[model samples]
Target: MISFRPVDVDSDAEMEMLHRWVTHPKAAFWLMQDFDVEQVREEYRRISEHPHHEAFLGLVDGNPAFLAERYDPGHVELVGLYEPEDGDVGMHFLCAPTDTPVHGFTRTVITAVLAWIFADPDALRVVVEPDVRNTAVHALNAAVGFRVVGPIAKPEKQALLSVCTWHDFQSATSALPRLGASL
Candidate 1:
């Protein structure tokens, strides 16, 4: 089972683990490959301090497997980028790199994360602004119900803004296998 907990940036071991994952070549989209451990600590510390933002560590059957971030679009990431609506929340997730790849693992993780987010009564819709160049994530997001809202320019990179509502997610996952059903 996949579960989540608040990231404890104060823990050296956790920070080290996060550092290794973020610095890995596959994490280019994460934009922190050149950062040292302290830089990661500083960045996550900043996130931890933000009122509308929070980071979570994802665990699969008790071992760390991914990281997810949740933020209020109205108050943080999408502030001036676009108009924000009530109950709109922003999401970002990263799976740990592995030597053994599993088909549908990314799908399951994202489905789980979105489900987790929707569990919050206030979260009616999920938002994301991933880099346009990250085509893999675009496909993954589509499988989970996100609809492209067109491209938007950000200081860092051009991004594809997408949104997935509760209904959209439900419709998308209705025919899909869930976490415990052999996937």
Candidate 2:
């Protein structure tokens, strides 16, 4: 079963685990590989305290398995990053490091995150800006109902803008499989 809870970044072990995940090679696109542990700690602290964003620890069968965050595009992630459109919400996610990748894990993680976001009364759409070169995540995002809106040049890299409105998400995923029995 998969579930999400607000992360307590001040916790020592959780912070350490997050540090390792962000520094891993699989997390290269996250653009935090060169960050020190303290930087990661500080980043999490800021996110935890940010009013327009939220960070969550995802658990599968009671074990921490992923990290997910949601932000209002007009506030945090897309603040001056893009021309804000009404109802735009941004999202970021990173799966825990694992030697053996499991089938359907990405699908489950995204589904759980989407479920959580849709639970918010004011949320109207989900948006993502992943590096265009990250095909794996592009596929995962598409699986979860995000349709590419085109590429946007960023200071760091070219990002593929994708979006999923509530209606589109509902229509596309209505018959799709959910993450686990818990979802």
lDDT of each: 0.91, 0.84
Could you tell me every candidate's TM-score relative to the true structure? 0.96, 0.91
Q: List the candidate 2 regions with Cα displacement exceeding 4 Å.
A: 178-183
True lDDT of residue 48, candidate 2: 84
Clash tally, candidates in order: 0, 0
- The lDDT of model 1 is 0.91
Q: How close to the true structure is residue 10 of candidate 1, measured as C-alpha lDDT?
A: 100
Which residue pairs show backbone clashes in model 1? none
Candidate 2 root-mean-square deviation in Å = 2.1
Q: What's the lDDT for candidate 2?
A: 0.84
Top candidate, metric lDDT: 1
Please list all clashing residue pairs in model 2, or write none if there are none. none
Q: What is the lDDT of residue 77 in candidate 1?
A: 80
